[model samples]
Target: MSKRGSGLFFAILLAFALILSACGNNNGGGNQGGGSEGGKSSGGGDNKTLSLLTGGTGGTYYPLGGSMAQIISDETDYNANAQSSGASAENMQALKNGEADIAFSQTDIAAYALNGELMFKDNKVDNVKAIGTLYPETVQIITTKGSGINSVEDLKGKSVSVGAPGSGVNANAQQILEIHGLSFDDIKAQSLSFDESTDGIQSGSIDAAFITAGTPTAAVESLSAQKEIRVIPIADDKIKQLIEKYPYYAEDTVPKGTYKIPEDVKTVAVKAMLVVRDDMPEDDVYAITKAIFENTDKITHAKGKLIKAETALDGIGDLPLHPGAEKYFSEKGVQK
Candidate 1:
């Protein structure tokens, strides 16, 4: 072969080799079939990942979030995963920073994030939007049977676990105390999580704890199973005051069988809410909201509580509803 012809053949061969190498790379989980079955096209830049931010490992949010992630993955093409977080306040920051796609938060905290109140202070997170309201978490003021802390007023001059710092529970605890005309100076306040607070109660280090959670709360239930405890009732007058000032506070009754109480206890509650960033695709968010409510049974089975689709629109405060969620609820004939 001529020398010029040989050079031409070599150039063509090099180009062919580069094309084969590119094909090999593409076949190695690139654009085509990269995600697992039922998962999103995460390997490609066009697909968005669904990350659900939940509370600590032992809390209700974590397990419920895991269940929700599974539902999203099974019901939609999004790749969803649940992450352990510090709950409400922290989840809000995560969503705002674009680090998470969905989060579980207390309605009051969501309001605060939206309006720049309480922990949010002067800097507000305006990008957050509500998907829907979940179940109500009763604010239970619990102590040992002999603690003599029968009402909110009795918490004065006592040691109290307000809740962990930077958490929505902490804000609720402070509100309840303030409504009772007591301040942190009136009591020895301890910032602790539910498990930590219960541990303090068990060890006799804490006098009382303001626990905001669902009825038959895991921590409170465990405490009741091992030792007798008292759930202080919030008087109707106090409930009225709380609701008057904060419409997010709702009336809830902890049934007699819940915990060690023999009689039903009256308390105020905050609704748990699912939230998303405002920039999330409306259609995707709509589908997620619909999937969650439409398959309430799946959530109930995973979390052991009935979530009625009809009540989803009831307690979602003034926090702006995601357009997608609003559309879904409207289609169900439910209006906010």
Candidate 2:
């Protein structure tokens, strides 16, 4: 063949190859994120990716997910990407839409999504399943110490940021408020994240907001440092009934030391959960779940020690355990 013809032929081959590679990448969906150890590779290649969906950048879920993704990438060859959404509800939606392969969520939201209950009413996410419980999320309500908001009842007529709609924190706050006869109306509602809410209160845009997190949240800590931030104590007797009705909740205390509190602050708490779609390969799910437990230190140091696999890996979430995850726990002899 002529030299010019040979060069043209090579260029055409390169272009066709590039097109094929792009096509392969486009077909991967969310699972192509390449963070799973045993995750399937692309275009029949031994490369994998796993997308982990968590909450807003202002919360624990995002940091915890960052840690998990770091661990996944460090311990394995898969490229893991941690996605940011509006927390539990939005994460579930991402999972259902195949935008994320795995997700970090609140147990209550996970249950609601799985059972098609409140927050997920009228539509069901039956494919949801839990890997394990990560940590407790204490309902943190802080008001300016001098706002005269000494009690939950005092929130009446005050402006409030109850978290973004469809978020687990928002749902929890809403449920608790309704039981207390307070709606978004009784207090002006500001659907903001922890950071935005902090700024809101500091700038006098709002009075108070419900912050459900593993204390001490950076936002709360910063606010408390600049001004007096009083943690509102939930009525124990009132919360008791709520806990009884909501099987996903428990009585958890954000110890005095967690924040500058007078004593142990009692509140209703829920477990954070790691979850995945039911259709994921059992081997892949097992590897992902096991990797998390094996690298508990990474998660603990991420935002808070939310996943103490040995001492605190409780399946407190309402969703059924993923079969792959069940296998990991069984092999480890950790009682579910």
**lDDT (10s digit) by residue, model 1, range 1-336:** 999999999999999999999987778565543233323434554434689998876567877888888888777657689998888999998888889989999988898888888888876898989998888878988899988888888988899998887688888887887888988889999998888888889999999998887677777888888779999999899889999988889899988977758999999999888999999878788878877787777774324355666788778857788988898888889887
Q: What is the lDDT of residue 112 in candidate 2?
A: 83
Ten consecutive residues with minimal summed lDDT in candidate 1? Answer: 32-41
lDDT of 2 by residue, 265-296 (tens): 77788877788888877777777777778877
Query: In model 2, which regions exceed 4 Å deviation?
Result: 1-46, 300-306, 310-318
Q: Residue-pair clashes per candidate, as listed?
A: 0, 10
User: What are the lDDT figures for the candidates, one per model?
Assistant: 0.83, 0.77
RMSD of each: 5.4, 7.1
